[model samples]
Target: MKLQAIFVGLVIVALSLFFLSPKVNSLPVGANVTSNTSSNWSAAIPSRTDAGGTITTMVLDAQSQDDGWKGYVGNISGKFTLDDASGYSIYDWSFTVTEGEVYISRAASPSWSTAICANTTIISNEQNYFGMTAAEYDIINKTFNETIHQSFRVGVVDIVNSSCSSAFTYVNDSKYPYINESTPFQEVLLQTGTDLIYAALLETDNEGFHTGYTYDFQAIVPDNRTNGVTTTYYFWAELGT
Candidate 1:
C-alpha cells in the first residue's frame, strides 16, 4: 500500500511540472520593426462612362513614402440627368477589376450636396423637394467628383453597381444618398493574416426626371502590405443611364 501511494505522488509531481513549464518562443526576430521602402506599384487602366450625361475617369495614383505601397487614392468621376416629369430616375455604374485582389471602396460628394438647405420648412411627401434639393443641383452640375476608396485584399473580377444594394447606400438620408463606400485603411487592417483581392461598386436611384443631374463614380486602391513589392491591378467603370 505504501509503494502504491509513493507511485501516485510521483505521477502528480510529473503532471504538475508538465503543465507549469514555460512555453517555447516561435516568432521571427525584429518582426515589429518599421521600414520605408519604395515599390513599383501601377494603376489599372481606367474606363469612361457617358450614361450619366457626363463621364470622367481618374487614374489611381499614389506615391510611396519611404518605400510604402502606392496606387490610386481619390474619386473616379461619372454623371446622369434627372427631370421632374418622370417619377422614377435610374442611374447605373460599374467597374471591372482583376479577380483575387482585395480593395476598400466608398462614395462621397462635395459638401454642397451634403449641406442642409436654407429653407427647412419646405417639406412634402409625394414631391419632397427639400430632400432632393441637392439632387436637383447634382443634375444641374452634370458631374462632380465623388470618391469611394477601399484597401489591400482581392475580389473576383466582375461588375458592381448601386443596384446591388449590399454594395451601396440604400437610405434616403442627406449624408450618403448615392453610394455606400469604405476605405482600405479600415478593411485591410481588420483582415490581418489573409491574402485576397477586394473590389467595390456604388450607384443611386432616380427619384424624379431631371434633365442634367449626374453622378460620378470612382474606385481607388491603396496597398497596405508590409512587404515592399509593387502590386498591379485593373478596374473598369460602366454607367447605366
Candidate 2:
C-alpha cells in the first residue's frame, strides 16, 4: 500500500510540472513593421498604372483567433502599408522573407468606395507575389531549439470599376507565370523562403482605365513544440525599403 501511494504521488507531481511549465518564446508568425515612414523608399517600388498616383505606407496589427492541436497555430500581428505609386492609385509591393512559419494576409475594398467605380477590377491574386525557403531558417534556437518555416501573402483591395481589373501574379525572370483573379480578399501559403515576394496591379486584357485600389500583407508563424514543451505562439512582420 505504501509503494502504491508513492507511485501515485509521483504521477501527480509529474502532471503538475507538465501543466505549470513556462512556454518557449518562438519567433512570431506574420508581418511586423519594426519602423515605417515615407522617407524609407529604397524597398518600395512603383507600380504600373495610367492614373499617375503615388504609393503610401502604413502599418497594421494582425491577430488570429483559431484554436487547434496543430493546424494554423499562431498569432499574426504586424505593420504593412499601401503603396500607391502608379499614376492611377494602383501600386506594387514586395518583401524579402526568411523561413520559419506559414503566414497569411487579408485585403478588402471597403463599402465606402462602392460609388467611386462599379466596374473596378479589385481582386486578390498570387502571381505577383514571390517566395523561397532558405537553409539558414533551419537553425534551432537555444531558447526554443525547434525548426521554423517562413511564409508571406499579398492582398488586393478596391478594384470595382467594370472596365478596370487588378490581380496578383507571379513573375519569373520578368515573365508572368501564374495570375489570381479573385479580388479584395485572397490568401497564399508560402513554403519556399529562397526568393523575393512581390504584389502588383494587373492590367486588363481589353485595355481600359486603371482604378484605385488598396491592399495588406501578412506573415504567419506556426506553433513550436519539442520534448513535451510548447512555445507561446506569436505572429510578426518586418518591413524593408
User: Which candidate number maximizes TM-score?
Assistant: 1
Backbone collision count in every prediction? 59, 59
lDDT tens digits by residue: candidate 2, 123-212: 112211211122323211111121121122222122222222222211221213333333322222221122212122222221121123
Q: In model 2, which runs have C-alpha deviations exceeding 4 angstroms?
A: 1-15, 19-30, 39-97, 100-241
TM-score of each: 0.20, 0.18
Clashes of 1: 59
Residue-level lDDT for 93 in candidate 2: 48
Which candidate should be chosen as best, given lDDT against the real structure?
1
lDDT of candidate 1 over 125-230, digit per residue (tens):
1013212334443221111123233322111212232211122212222234333344111111111122122233323422211224322222223333345444
What's the distance in Å from true for residue 6, model 2? 15
Q: lDDT per model, in order?
A: 0.28, 0.26
lDDT of 2: 0.26
